[model samples]
Target chain A: MMDAWDDYSEKVMDHYENPRNVGIVEKANGTGVVGNPACGDVMKLTIRVENDIIVDAKFKTFGCGAAIATSSMVTEMVKGKSLADALEISNRGVMEALGGLPKVKRHCSVLAEEALKAAIADYEKNRRDISPAA
Target chain B: MNLIYMDHHATTPLDAEVLAAMMPALTSEYGNPSSNTHAYGHAARYMVDSARAQVAQLVGAPRPDDIIFTSGATEADNLALKGIAHAKDYMPARNIVTLAIEHKAVLDAARRLQKENVEIRFAAIDPYGVVDLDDLAAKIDKNTILISIQTANSEIGTIQPIREIGVIAKKHGVPFHTDAVQALGRYEIDVMRDHIDMLSISAHKMYGPKGIGALYVRRGLKLTPIIDGGGHERNMRSGTLNVPGIVGLGKAAEIAKRDLKSESERLLKLRNRLEDGILRRIEHVRINGHPTNRLPNNLNVAFAYVEGESLILACRGVALSSGSACTSTSLQSSYVLKAINVPDFLAHGSLRFGLGKSNSEEHVDIVLDLLEKGVRRLREMSPLYDMAKEGVSIESAHFSRHARGK
Candidate 1:
């Protein structure tokens, strides 16, 4: 593409311009960090849960607009969904949520999905570690 | 409306004196510098020689005869690499050493050479873009034909210790070439004192015309010409001398030499104010490159959670570039940033702000304000920010329960 961002939808631009979720969450059920040294992007996701419902979601991303926006959109998509449903949230779904991404920015959506999955896995493992002999 | 031109590192406006000097060559001096038979040819030849002297003086070279004009830095770089490599056709061993953060003019040249079974060794770099001198020293061996590095980086504006690198190369009996396109008038350089074998410079970088440049060759260095023709440029390059360009280059160099020190100081002050303002107003912003060994007018910063391209687009009226300018062609980001170990996340969010003679304190203030507002707005729409505010780490919420955004 002549311009990498020219292909982004309005929703993608919106999320990129006004990202929904950003910052950090401490001492939570799970946390995940993803970094791509090639592109110089880093992402850290944290989540809180209460009885199978995510209470809150936050992220700290050191990436471009697409990466940040994708993270924000992913958090919004998974906020109230069950862990199983969130895990099923593919990168495609995140891209769809933002109306689609430029081919170059495809990695941004992938990173968002990976971060979410990583965080969910962390939460599941934590629950298993603290379970009362279920 | 005054259009503040702070992107001098990108390209400088042609100096008026240079334009005046070039007019006669363009209008009446039509004979080729190589054509020794006519007045036109003699005049063009003299202009070319005068231009060469001007360029040599700016770089502290001993004589004008040591310089060879080229299309620009890119061509000069290619000639330095391929010309030297091809010259060693009689030798069996072929190896090259260069830093990871070199401009594509060098890096891509190395890459192309590698395709021909040449062994390429890249020196590691610190986050500040300094070549690991020890690592470079260790990589040197008998077969090491050339050590290529740049004087100053265009992206982060990091200045490499070319003199030190030259000494190391000499110790190993290797030829040293530096692409000083970004360093020509901005920094003090002496080809002989620094022990540099070959140096490339472009006119546009120093307020001369574009598509005109020169390469400095030490008195005794031997290399074949990459371009073939009527034996111009002392049989090193073949094209007829660009008389108008040469005259323009000479005038520009004279002007740059006269005003360089004061202009640099002014640019430094403006850059400092801009940097200080951004650091104070923004959260999670980091400056890239070494504080002390960088260009006075260049500033690179990482704004967390914001994309460099987006920021540039939002600030469309600002007329600044994002990192290396060359990497704008690819989604892969800047090779300079990658080589310096800038994390992909931060690299993607990197912004390159180069100041020029046209920029003033007022321009800096405007840029600072626009940047602050732009980043804040982008952060607000981020879902990650919302989740963090709610005291939830995405990892914990991922496995047990998913709360789809309401």
Candidate 2:
């Protein structure tokens, strides 16, 4: 039988092998973590959101190659975008960037998008709490 | 890359001797066994009868007539469950009792039977994947018609207590069936001694040709035919015989019987060496399945920080399965490991190695080396693994509460 990696595109395999932006951003302005412990894939995304634009983004994910690659791709996708634009970046965009994941690994792409939104949401929550604009 | 096949539970390479036995059938011996009135037919009939006797002997059944040929174990399983459930004599006892971890063939058949208003009861298994005897005892009542459990799980390789379960079935007077597709060639099974009323075996699983199998039904038991046709195989199964495949199955069975004891011993030693090597080399790794009751040729281990899919993908040089091939398409890890209450990380990270005739000490060592390297590489990329090594409980780690229903 053919290996499961055969279903993946060369780009997905490349991103998985040499994942970019790996590690934590401690004391970051906004941090998002998503995934179910029961499901065996988890993601923690840290972002430096300054003046409504994402200045820097980094990720640490625990999942299959697709999830890790998607997270890495998501970090790159949102690096220079506004929070609204980052939020607009869909899971499909991440999957497309990676060429594609297998049918079974498509769910990992969703994890990438969710982790980003969660980080942005965390930023909004932290901002609202600190600001008198509430 | 030269791939070393470690996935014997999926299927095995055809034995050379079995191929030799099947050559005549595949070549010049093309006579129809049903044409018994002439020499051409008589010769075919002779080959069929001899093959039938070999199959019966392998399973320790008294009468050769007790076996019915089918396409494969899937068909055999379907016939056993559906044939018996549809039997006029068994309608009053309308319940089917089987384990949760049975192959999809048995489980799917039971689902179909349930749709026909047959009550299907799934017996629970313990943490080690052994059927709970107490749960089974409570489930099998007078209304339970058939009790089906696998002799050995195809994924975890945990062998069930079939003899004890068979004794219970006998006490309740319910017919017992076992999907012995994985156990027959690897272990010894005697239908009479085990009180098995019916058993399922497939040729491809035993180093025989594919597309052939047999269902052993205790004599004097009547079955409602699933395939109604030329009334072949004493009306139990109907259709033209797969003469070549049958000959291969027969030869495979004969060889299995002859080599079972010695081969199992060798496999056991090799399996232990491979398993021990992995345990010694890696941290946070565990051996899955029963400690003593597992198949001699099977080794399942859970690598703490890696997903099985990723591991198999990287170690393409060693052919392996994360679970059964049937369910590998799904991403939910393994239901067998889940049913046994193994943690999700460990369960998702498990690999099943089915050592067979082709595997040797060299192959085992290479696989172990590949596994150690692969697990280490994958763990380096896993952040949850980072937390684990630092003694931080993953369950206690704070996670953002994004709505996950989508």
Q: By lDDT, who's the top model here?
A: 2
For all predictions, the C-alpha RMSD in Å is 6.2, 2.5
Off by over 4 Å in 1: A1-134, B1-4, B323-327, B383-406
Task: List the candidate 2 regions with Cα displacement exceeding 4 Å.
Answer: A50-55, A80-85, A131-134, B323-327, B389-398, B401-406
> Mind giving the per-residue lDDT tens digits that candidate 1 earns over B232-285?
887888887877887888888887788879888887898899999999999878
> Which predicted model would earn the best TM-score?
2
lDDT of 2 by residue, A1-134 (tens): 46666778988888777788887776678888888555767788999988999988999876676777898899999998999899899989999888877776787898999999989998999999998983
Report lDDT (Cα) of residue B258, candidate 1: 80
| TM-score list, all predictions | 0.77, 0.93
The CA lDDT at B344 in model 2 is 74
TM-score of chain B of 1: 0.93
